[model samples]
Target: MSEYHVPVLLGPSIDGLDIRPEGIYVDATFGGGGHAKEIAQRLDDKGHLFVFDQDEDAEANLWGATNVTLITSNFRHLTRWMKYYDVIGRVDGILADLGVSSHQFDDPSRGFSYRYDEPLDMRMNRQQLLSAADVINQYDAVQLQDIFRSTEK
Candidate 1:
Protein backbone atom coordinates (compact mmCIF):
# COMPACT_ATOMS: atom_id res chain seq x y z
CA MET A 1 0.00 0.00 0.00
CA SER A 2 2.12 2.85 -1.25
CA GLU A 3 1.18 6.39 -0.28
CA TYR A 4 0.14 8.64 -3.13
CA HIS A 5 1.42 12.01 -1.87
CA VAL A 6 4.66 10.36 -0.78
CA PRO A 7 6.85 9.25 -3.67
CA VAL A 8 7.88 5.54 -3.65
CA LEU A 9 11.64 6.12 -3.70
CA LEU A 10 12.10 9.84 -3.38
CA GLY A 11 15.74 10.25 -2.38
CA PRO A 12 17.34 7.35 -4.33
CA SER A 13 15.28 8.02 -7.45
CA ILE A 14 15.98 11.76 -7.42
CA ASP A 15 19.62 11.20 -6.57
CA GLY A 16 20.04 8.73 -9.42
CA LEU A 17 19.18 11.50 -11.90
CA ASP A 18 22.03 13.79 -10.81
CA ILE A 19 19.65 16.56 -11.71
CA ARG A 20 20.97 19.77 -13.21
CA PRO A 21 19.27 22.82 -11.70
CA GLU A 22 18.63 24.24 -15.17
CA GLY A 23 17.87 20.97 -17.00
CA ILE A 24 14.57 19.66 -18.30
CA TYR A 25 12.84 16.59 -16.79
CA VAL A 26 9.74 14.55 -17.44
CA ASP A 27 7.45 12.85 -14.91
CA ALA A 28 5.67 10.39 -17.18
CA THR A 29 3.19 9.17 -14.58
CA PHE A 30 2.18 12.04 -12.35
CA GLY A 31 -0.26 10.16 -10.13
CA GLY A 32 -0.20 12.49 -7.09
CA GLY A 33 2.51 14.91 -8.21
CA GLY A 34 4.87 13.72 -5.47
CA HIS A 35 7.79 13.16 -7.84
CA ALA A 36 6.90 16.24 -9.87
CA LYS A 37 6.88 18.42 -6.74
CA GLU A 38 10.31 17.13 -5.74
CA ILE A 39 11.67 17.73 -9.24
CA ALA A 40 10.17 21.21 -9.33
CA GLN A 41 11.83 22.03 -6.03
CA ARG A 42 15.21 21.08 -7.43
CA LEU A 43 14.72 23.08 -10.63
CA ASP A 44 15.93 26.63 -10.98
CA ASP A 45 13.90 29.26 -12.84
CA LYS A 46 15.46 27.99 -16.06
CA GLY A 47 14.55 24.36 -15.39
CA HIS A 48 11.29 22.84 -16.56
CA LEU A 49 9.35 19.74 -15.37
CA PHE A 50 6.73 18.32 -17.68
CA VAL A 51 4.33 15.96 -15.89
CA PHE A 52 1.74 13.78 -17.59
CA ASP A 53 -1.37 11.94 -16.31
CA GLN A 54 -4.47 10.81 -18.14
CA ASP A 55 -6.79 10.74 -15.15
CA GLU A 56 -8.47 14.13 -14.83
CA ASP A 57 -8.38 13.76 -11.04
CA ALA A 58 -4.60 14.14 -11.15
CA GLU A 59 -5.05 17.81 -12.10
CA ALA A 60 -6.10 18.58 -8.52
CA ASN A 61 -2.70 17.48 -7.21
CA LEU A 62 -0.80 19.96 -9.39
CA TRP A 63 1.20 22.58 -7.54
CA GLY A 64 1.48 26.27 -8.34
CA ALA A 65 5.06 26.01 -9.51
CA THR A 66 6.09 27.98 -12.56
CA ASN A 67 8.62 25.30 -13.51
CA VAL A 68 6.02 22.53 -13.63
CA THR A 69 3.92 21.92 -16.74
CA LEU A 70 0.97 19.53 -16.21
CA ILE A 71 -0.09 17.76 -19.38
CA THR A 72 -3.59 16.27 -19.16
CA SER A 73 -2.83 13.27 -21.33
CA ASN A 74 -1.55 9.71 -21.04
CA PHE A 75 2.21 9.25 -20.84
CA ARG A 76 1.95 6.96 -23.90
CA HIS A 77 2.15 10.13 -26.01
CA LEU A 78 5.31 11.23 -24.24
CA THR A 79 7.33 11.63 -27.43
CA ARG A 80 4.56 13.64 -29.07
CA TRP A 81 4.29 15.99 -26.12
CA MET A 82 8.04 16.38 -25.94
CA LYS A 83 8.11 17.32 -29.62
CA TYR A 84 5.25 19.76 -29.11
CA TYR A 85 7.13 21.46 -26.25
CA ASP A 86 10.42 21.36 -28.24
CA VAL A 87 12.12 19.44 -25.43
CA ILE A 88 12.35 16.07 -27.22
CA GLY A 89 16.10 15.69 -27.15
CA ARG A 90 16.76 18.10 -24.29
CA VAL A 91 15.26 16.07 -21.41
CA ASP A 92 17.86 15.36 -18.76
CA GLY A 93 15.86 12.57 -17.10
CA ILE A 94 12.54 10.76 -17.20
CA LEU A 95 10.66 9.35 -14.20
CA ALA A 96 7.78 6.93 -14.48
CA ASP A 97 5.93 5.66 -11.39
CA LEU A 98 4.00 2.91 -13.13
CA GLY A 99 1.93 1.45 -10.29
CA VAL A 100 -1.47 1.86 -8.73
CA SER A 101 -1.36 4.53 -6.05
CA SER A 102 -2.79 4.05 -2.56
CA HIS A 103 -5.01 7.06 -3.17
CA GLN A 104 -7.09 4.94 -5.54
CA PHE A 105 -7.22 1.87 -3.28
CA ASP A 106 -8.08 3.80 -0.14
CA ASP A 107 -11.06 5.38 -1.81
CA PRO A 108 -13.87 2.85 -1.31
CA SER A 109 -15.77 4.12 -4.33
CA ARG A 110 -12.82 3.44 -6.60
CA GLY A 111 -13.18 -0.35 -6.06
CA PHE A 112 -9.49 -1.10 -6.34
CA SER A 113 -9.06 -3.14 -3.16
CA TYR A 114 -11.42 -6.00 -2.46
CA ARG A 115 -11.88 -5.04 1.18
CA TYR A 116 -14.68 -2.74 0.12
CA ASP A 117 -17.31 -4.42 -2.06
CA GLU A 118 -18.26 -1.47 -4.21
CA PRO A 119 -18.77 -1.38 -7.97
CA LEU A 120 -15.46 -2.72 -9.27
CA ASP A 121 -14.55 0.24 -11.42
CA MET A 122 -10.80 -0.29 -11.59
CA ARG A 123 -10.11 2.26 -14.27
CA MET A 124 -7.38 4.86 -14.11
CA ASN A 125 -9.59 6.93 -16.37
CA ARG A 126 -13.23 6.75 -15.33
CA GLN A 127 -14.16 8.19 -18.73
CA GLN A 128 -13.51 4.76 -20.21
CA LEU A 129 -16.60 2.56 -20.58
CA LEU A 130 -14.72 -0.68 -19.87
CA SER A 131 -14.27 -1.43 -16.16
CA ALA A 132 -13.29 -4.24 -13.83
CA ALA A 133 -16.97 -4.86 -13.16
CA ASP A 134 -17.63 -5.19 -16.87
CA VAL A 135 -14.71 -7.54 -17.27
CA ILE A 136 -15.59 -9.81 -14.37
CA ASN A 137 -19.30 -9.92 -15.00
CA GLN A 138 -19.19 -10.23 -18.78
CA TYR A 139 -16.03 -12.19 -19.46
CA ASP A 140 -16.26 -15.98 -19.31
CA ALA A 141 -13.82 -18.09 -17.31
CA VAL A 142 -11.88 -18.96 -20.47
CA GLN A 143 -11.75 -15.33 -21.46
CA LEU A 144 -10.42 -14.34 -18.04
CA GLN A 145 -7.81 -17.11 -18.26
CA ASP A 146 -6.74 -15.87 -21.66
CA ILE A 147 -6.45 -12.31 -20.36
CA PHE A 148 -4.43 -13.48 -17.34
CA ARG A 149 -2.15 -15.56 -19.53
CA SER A 150 -1.52 -12.63 -21.83
CA THR A 151 0.01 -10.75 -18.92
CA GLU A 152 2.47 -13.54 -18.09
CA LYS A 153 6.15 -13.26 -18.96
Candidate 2:
Protein backbone atom coordinates (compact mmCIF):
# COMPACT_ATOMS: atom_id res chain seq x y z
CA MET A 1 0.00 0.00 0.00
CA SER A 2 1.19 3.51 -0.73
CA GLU A 3 1.76 5.64 2.38
CA TYR A 4 -1.02 8.04 1.35
CA HIS A 5 -4.04 5.84 0.63
CA VAL A 6 -6.23 4.44 3.43
CA PRO A 7 -9.24 2.22 2.89
CA VAL A 8 -12.56 3.84 3.72
CA LEU A 9 -15.96 2.45 4.72
CA LEU A 10 -14.25 -0.89 4.83
CA GLY A 11 -16.34 -2.60 7.52
CA PRO A 12 -19.75 -1.67 6.18
CA SER A 13 -18.74 -2.31 2.58
CA ILE A 14 -17.48 -5.83 3.26
CA ASP A 15 -20.36 -6.71 5.56
CA GLY A 16 -22.81 -5.53 2.95
CA LEU A 17 -21.42 -8.10 0.53
CA ASP A 18 -22.80 -10.89 2.77
CA ILE A 19 -20.23 -13.19 1.30
CA ARG A 20 -21.16 -16.80 0.72
CA PRO A 21 -18.58 -19.42 1.40
CA GLU A 22 -18.69 -20.53 -2.21
CA GLY A 23 -19.76 -17.35 -3.94
CA ILE A 24 -17.82 -15.07 -6.25
CA TYR A 25 -17.31 -11.39 -5.43
CA VAL A 26 -15.67 -8.45 -7.14
CA ASP A 27 -14.03 -5.45 -5.50
CA ALA A 28 -13.89 -3.00 -8.35
CA THR A 29 -11.60 -0.54 -6.63
CA PHE A 30 -9.07 -2.72 -4.88
CA GLY A 31 -7.00 0.09 -3.39
CA GLY A 32 -4.64 -1.48 -0.87
CA GLY A 33 -6.99 -4.52 -0.83
CA GLY A 34 -8.06 -3.79 2.76
CA HIS A 35 -11.68 -4.71 2.07
CA ALA A 36 -10.60 -7.56 -0.18
CA LYS A 37 -8.46 -8.95 2.64
CA GLU A 38 -11.42 -8.97 4.97
CA ILE A 39 -13.61 -10.60 2.35
CA ALA A 40 -10.95 -13.20 1.65
CA GLN A 41 -10.79 -14.10 5.34
CA ARG A 42 -14.51 -14.89 5.31
CA LEU A 43 -14.36 -17.03 2.19
CA ASP A 44 -13.83 -20.76 2.09
CA ASP A 45 -11.41 -22.48 -0.26
CA LYS A 46 -14.21 -22.68 -2.80
CA GLY A 47 -14.91 -18.94 -2.69
CA HIS A 48 -13.28 -16.42 -5.01
CA LEU A 49 -12.74 -12.65 -5.07
CA PHE A 50 -11.82 -10.67 -8.16
CA VAL A 51 -10.00 -7.42 -7.46
CA PHE A 52 -9.27 -4.54 -9.83
CA ASP A 53 -7.13 -1.43 -9.53
CA GLN A 54 -5.64 0.59 -12.35
CA ASP A 55 -2.71 1.78 -10.30
CA GLU A 56 0.28 -0.54 -10.50
CA ASP A 57 1.14 0.04 -6.83
CA ALA A 58 -2.18 -1.38 -5.71
CA GLU A 59 -1.22 -4.86 -6.97
CA ALA A 60 1.49 -5.14 -4.31
CA ASN A 61 -1.19 -5.30 -1.63
CA LEU A 62 -2.54 -8.69 -2.79
CA TRP A 63 -0.43 -10.66 -0.32
CA GLY A 64 -1.85 -13.52 1.81
CA ALA A 65 -5.10 -13.86 -0.16
CA THR A 66 -5.37 -17.39 -1.49
CA ASN A 67 -8.21 -17.25 -4.01
CA VAL A 68 -8.24 -13.80 -5.51
CA THR A 69 -7.71 -12.81 -9.13
CA LEU A 70 -6.26 -9.31 -9.45
CA ILE A 71 -6.70 -7.19 -12.54
CA THR A 72 -4.82 -4.01 -13.33
CA SER A 73 -7.45 -1.71 -14.76
CA ASN A 74 -9.89 1.03 -13.87
CA PHE A 75 -13.20 0.13 -12.27
CA ARG A 76 -15.13 1.92 -15.00
CA HIS A 77 -14.09 -0.92 -17.32
CA LEU A 78 -15.07 -3.51 -14.70
CA THR A 79 -17.80 -5.25 -16.68
CA ARG A 80 -15.48 -5.75 -19.63
CA TRP A 81 -12.55 -6.66 -17.43
CA MET A 82 -14.62 -9.27 -15.60
CA LYS A 83 -15.70 -10.72 -18.90
CA TYR A 84 -12.09 -10.84 -20.00
CA TYR A 85 -11.34 -12.73 -16.80
CA ASP A 86 -14.22 -15.16 -17.56
CA VAL A 87 -16.19 -14.16 -14.43
CA ILE A 88 -18.73 -11.70 -15.73
CA GLY A 89 -22.42 -11.75 -14.68
CA ARG A 90 -21.83 -14.82 -12.48
CA VAL A 91 -20.57 -12.58 -9.66
CA ASP A 92 -22.60 -12.91 -6.48
CA GLY A 93 -21.72 -9.41 -5.33
CA ILE A 94 -19.95 -6.33 -6.65
CA LEU A 95 -18.42 -3.63 -4.50
CA ALA A 96 -17.58 -0.24 -5.94
CA ASP A 97 -16.08 2.21 -3.47
CA LEU A 98 -15.70 5.26 -5.66
CA GLY A 99 -13.19 8.13 -5.32
CA VAL A 100 -9.46 8.32 -5.16
CA SER A 101 -7.74 6.69 -2.18
CA SER A 102 -6.18 8.69 0.63
CA HIS A 103 -2.74 7.52 -0.46
CA GLN A 104 -3.13 9.16 -3.83
CA PHE A 105 -4.02 12.48 -2.25
CA ASP A 106 -1.28 12.24 0.32
CA ASP A 107 1.57 11.20 -1.93
CA PRO A 108 3.11 14.45 -3.14
CA SER A 109 4.54 12.85 -6.25
CA ARG A 110 1.12 11.59 -7.38
CA GLY A 111 -0.02 15.25 -7.72
CA PHE A 112 -3.57 14.55 -6.66
CA SER A 113 -3.81 17.48 -4.24
CA TYR A 114 -3.59 21.11 -5.16
CA ARG A 115 -2.37 21.88 -1.66
CA TYR A 116 0.94 20.17 -2.46
CA ASP A 117 3.62 21.75 -4.63
CA GLU A 118 4.24 19.14 -7.32
CA PRO A 119 3.67 18.58 -11.01
CA LEU A 120 -0.04 18.32 -11.73
CA ASP A 121 -0.63 14.65 -12.53
CA MET A 122 -3.75 13.07 -11.04
CA ARG A 123 -4.11 9.90 -13.04
CA MET A 124 -5.29 6.76 -11.26
CA ASN A 125 -3.71 4.75 -14.03
CA ARG A 126 -0.18 6.03 -14.39
CA GLN A 127 -0.29 4.67 -17.93
CA GLN A 128 -2.94 7.18 -18.94
CA LEU A 129 -1.83 10.20 -20.99
CA LEU A 130 -4.43 12.75 -19.92
CA SER A 131 -3.02 13.90 -16.61
CA ALA A 132 -4.10 16.86 -14.49
CA ALA A 133 -1.11 18.70 -15.89
CA ASP A 134 -2.04 17.88 -19.44
CA VAL A 135 -5.56 19.12 -18.87
CA ILE A 136 -4.54 22.32 -17.13
CA ASN A 137 -1.60 23.18 -19.32
CA GLN A 138 -3.26 22.28 -22.59
CA TYR A 139 -6.84 23.34 -22.06
CA ASP A 140 -7.81 26.97 -22.54
CA ALA A 141 -9.06 28.97 -19.55
CA VAL A 142 -12.67 28.55 -20.64
CA GLN A 143 -12.26 24.82 -21.00
CA LEU A 144 -10.57 24.60 -17.65
CA GLN A 145 -13.44 26.44 -16.01
CA ASP A 146 -15.91 24.16 -17.72
CA ILE A 147 -14.07 21.08 -16.55
CA PHE A 148 -13.95 22.34 -12.99
CA ARG A 149 -17.64 23.16 -12.98
CA SER A 150 -18.69 19.91 -14.59
CA THR A 151 -16.57 17.76 -12.34
CA GLU A 152 -17.93 19.48 -9.26
CA LYS A 153 -20.84 17.87 -7.49
Candidate 3:
Protein backbone atom coordinates (compact mmCIF):
# COMPACT_ATOMS: atom_id res chain seq x y z
CA MET A 1 0.00 0.00 0.00
CA SER A 2 1.24 3.53 -0.72
CA GLU A 3 2.09 5.46 2.40
CA TYR A 4 -0.14 8.35 1.34
CA HIS A 5 -3.14 6.14 0.50
CA VAL A 6 -5.71 4.91 3.00
CA PRO A 7 -9.06 3.24 2.40
CA VAL A 8 -12.08 5.08 3.70
CA LEU A 9 -15.22 3.50 5.16
CA LEU A 10 -13.80 0.17 4.08
CA GLY A 11 -15.66 -2.21 6.41
CA PRO A 12 -19.02 -0.52 6.13
CA SER A 13 -18.71 -0.17 2.37
CA ILE A 14 -17.91 -3.85 1.82
CA ASP A 15 -20.61 -5.00 4.24
CA GLY A 16 -23.12 -2.87 2.38
CA LEU A 17 -22.25 -4.58 -0.89
CA ASP A 18 -23.75 -7.85 0.42
CA ILE A 19 -21.45 -9.74 -1.90
CA ARG A 20 -22.59 -12.87 -3.70
CA PRO A 21 -19.88 -15.39 -4.43
CA GLU A 22 -20.96 -16.10 -7.99
CA GLY A 23 -21.84 -12.52 -8.81
CA ILE A 24 -19.93 -9.96 -10.82
CA TYR A 25 -18.93 -6.71 -9.10
CA VAL A 26 -17.40 -3.43 -10.16
CA ASP A 27 -15.28 -1.07 -8.13
CA ALA A 28 -15.49 2.29 -9.83
CA THR A 29 -12.80 3.91 -7.73
CA PHE A 30 -9.93 1.50 -7.27
CA GLY A 31 -7.63 4.11 -5.65
CA GLY A 32 -5.05 1.78 -4.14
CA GLY A 33 -7.12 -1.38 -4.61
CA GLY A 34 -7.75 -1.45 -0.88
CA HIS A 35 -11.48 -2.09 -1.15
CA ALA A 36 -10.95 -4.25 -4.21
CA LYS A 37 -8.59 -6.51 -2.30
CA GLU A 38 -11.13 -7.00 0.47
CA ILE A 39 -13.88 -7.68 -2.05
CA ALA A 40 -11.68 -10.14 -3.93
CA GLN A 41 -10.98 -12.07 -0.73
CA ARG A 42 -14.69 -12.67 -0.19
CA LEU A 43 -15.34 -13.73 -3.75
CA ASP A 44 -15.35 -17.36 -4.84
CA ASP A 45 -13.59 -18.54 -7.97
CA LYS A 46 -16.74 -17.86 -9.95
CA GLY A 47 -16.95 -14.26 -8.76
CA HIS A 48 -15.55 -11.48 -10.90
CA LEU A 49 -14.55 -7.88 -10.18
CA PHE A 50 -13.89 -5.11 -12.67
CA VAL A 51 -11.88 -2.28 -11.18
CA PHE A 52 -11.75 1.12 -12.84
CA ASP A 53 -9.19 3.83 -12.21
CA GLN A 54 -8.16 6.51 -14.63
CA ASP A 55 -4.72 6.70 -13.04
CA GLU A 56 -2.11 4.51 -14.70
CA ASP A 57 -0.31 4.10 -11.40
CA ALA A 58 -3.23 2.00 -10.18
CA GLU A 59 -1.99 -0.84 -12.39
CA ALA A 60 0.90 -1.34 -9.99
CA ASN A 61 -1.59 -2.53 -7.38
CA LEU A 62 -2.91 -5.39 -9.53
CA TRP A 63 -0.10 -7.89 -8.90
CA GLY A 64 -1.65 -11.07 -7.46
CA ALA A 65 -5.33 -10.91 -8.28
CA THR A 66 -6.43 -13.68 -10.62
CA ASN A 67 -10.12 -13.05 -11.26
CA VAL A 68 -9.94 -9.30 -11.51
CA THR A 69 -10.22 -7.10 -14.57
CA LEU A 70 -8.55 -3.72 -14.22
CA ILE A 71 -9.51 -0.97 -16.58
CA THR A 72 -7.42 2.16 -16.89
CA SER A 73 -10.31 4.46 -17.64
CA ASN A 74 -12.60 6.92 -15.97
CA PHE A 75 -15.64 5.62 -14.08
CA ARG A 76 -17.91 7.86 -16.17
CA HIS A 77 -17.37 5.33 -18.96
CA LEU A 78 -18.33 2.43 -16.70
CA THR A 79 -21.49 1.37 -18.49
CA ARG A 80 -19.94 1.61 -21.95
CA TRP A 81 -16.76 -0.29 -21.04
CA MET A 82 -18.62 -2.88 -18.98
CA LYS A 83 -20.64 -3.69 -22.08
CA TYR A 84 -17.44 -3.88 -24.08
CA TYR A 85 -16.17 -6.40 -21.53
CA ASP A 86 -19.45 -8.40 -21.81
CA VAL A 87 -20.42 -7.47 -18.26
CA ILE A 88 -23.17 -4.91 -18.83
CA GLY A 89 -26.29 -6.98 -18.28
CA ARG A 90 -24.58 -9.59 -16.11
CA VAL A 91 -23.42 -7.23 -13.37
CA ASP A 92 -24.61 -8.37 -9.96
CA GLY A 93 -23.19 -5.53 -7.90
CA ILE A 94 -21.65 -2.08 -8.40
CA LEU A 95 -19.73 -0.04 -5.87
CA ALA A 96 -18.48 3.47 -6.49
CA ASP A 97 -16.66 5.33 -3.77
CA LEU A 98 -16.35 8.66 -5.46
CA GLY A 99 -14.19 11.72 -4.60
CA VAL A 100 -10.47 12.33 -4.59
CA SER A 101 -8.16 9.93 -2.78
CA SER A 102 -5.86 10.72 0.10
CA HIS A 103 -2.78 10.28 -2.06
CA GLN A 104 -4.07 12.87 -4.51
CA PHE A 105 -4.45 15.36 -1.72
CA ASP A 106 -1.08 14.57 -0.17
CA ASP A 107 0.90 14.73 -3.41
CA PRO A 108 1.75 18.42 -3.74
CA SER A 109 2.30 18.17 -7.47
CA ARG A 110 -1.16 16.78 -8.18
CA GLY A 111 -2.50 20.20 -7.13
CA PHE A 112 -5.68 18.96 -5.48
CA SER A 113 -5.13 20.91 -2.29
CA TYR A 114 -5.20 24.61 -1.47
CA ARG A 115 -2.99 24.00 1.56
CA TYR A 116 0.07 23.93 -0.66
CA ASP A 117 1.19 26.40 -3.32
CA GLU A 118 1.70 24.30 -6.46
CA PRO A 119 0.80 24.56 -10.09
CA LEU A 120 -2.89 23.76 -10.33
CA ASP A 121 -3.02 20.38 -12.10
CA MET A 122 -5.90 18.43 -10.65
CA ARG A 123 -6.57 16.08 -13.50
CA MET A 124 -7.76 12.83 -11.95
CA ASN A 125 -7.17 11.38 -15.36
CA ARG A 126 -3.70 12.68 -16.06
CA GLN A 127 -4.36 12.01 -19.71
CA GLN A 128 -7.20 14.54 -19.76
CA LEU A 129 -6.51 17.96 -21.25
CA LEU A 130 -8.62 20.04 -18.90
CA SER A 131 -6.86 20.30 -15.60
CA ALA A 132 -7.42 22.58 -12.59
CA ALA A 133 -4.95 25.01 -14.08
CA ASP A 134 -6.82 25.12 -17.35
CA VAL A 135 -10.08 25.64 -15.53
CA ILE A 136 -8.74 28.43 -13.40
CA ASN A 137 -6.63 30.14 -16.01
CA GLN A 138 -8.86 29.79 -19.06
CA TYR A 139 -12.44 29.81 -17.86
CA ASP A 140 -14.17 33.13 -17.21
CA ALA A 141 -14.84 34.09 -13.60
CA VAL A 142 -18.57 33.43 -13.94
CA GLN A 143 -17.93 29.98 -15.35
CA LEU A 144 -15.54 29.18 -12.54
CA GLN A 145 -18.08 30.35 -9.97
CA ASP A 146 -20.76 28.26 -11.61
CA ILE A 147 -18.57 25.16 -11.50
CA PHE A 148 -17.77 25.72 -7.85
CA ARG A 149 -21.41 26.20 -6.93
CA SER A 150 -22.56 23.20 -8.93
CA THR A 151 -19.92 20.94 -7.43
CA GLU A 152 -20.71 22.14 -3.91
CA LYS A 153 -24.31 21.08 -4.32
True-vs-predicted CA distance for residue 25, candidate 2, Å: 0.4
lDDT tens digits, residues 86-109, model 3?
Answer: 878998888888888887888898
The full ranking of all candidates by lDDT, starting with the best, is 3, 1, 2
> Is 2 or 3 the stronger prediction by TM-score?
3
lDDT of 1 by residue, 15-97 (tens): 88889999999998888887788888999999999998887778888768889999988788999999999998999999998
Per-residue C-alpha lDDT of model 2 across residues 1-153, encoded as one tens digit per residue: 335356777788888888898989988888877788888888899889998889998877878567998989877788897788787778899888788988788888999898888998989898897998888778998998897899896
2 versus 3: better lDDT goes to: 3
- Any runs in candidate 3 off by more than 4 Å, and if so which? 1-4, 145-153
Per-residue lDDT for 78 in model 3? 89
Off by over 4 Å in 1: 1-4, 141-146
TM-score, one value per model: 0.89, 0.86, 0.89
Worst 10 residues of 3 by lDDT: 1-10
Q: Whole-model Cα lDDT per candidate?
A: 0.87, 0.84, 0.87
**Candidate 3 clashes between residue pairs 3 or more apart in a chain or in different chains:** none
Q: What's the distance in Å from true for residue 60, model 2?
A: 1.3
- The TM-score obtained by model 3 is 0.89
Q: Show the colliding residue pairs in model 2.
A: 4-102, 4-103, 5-103
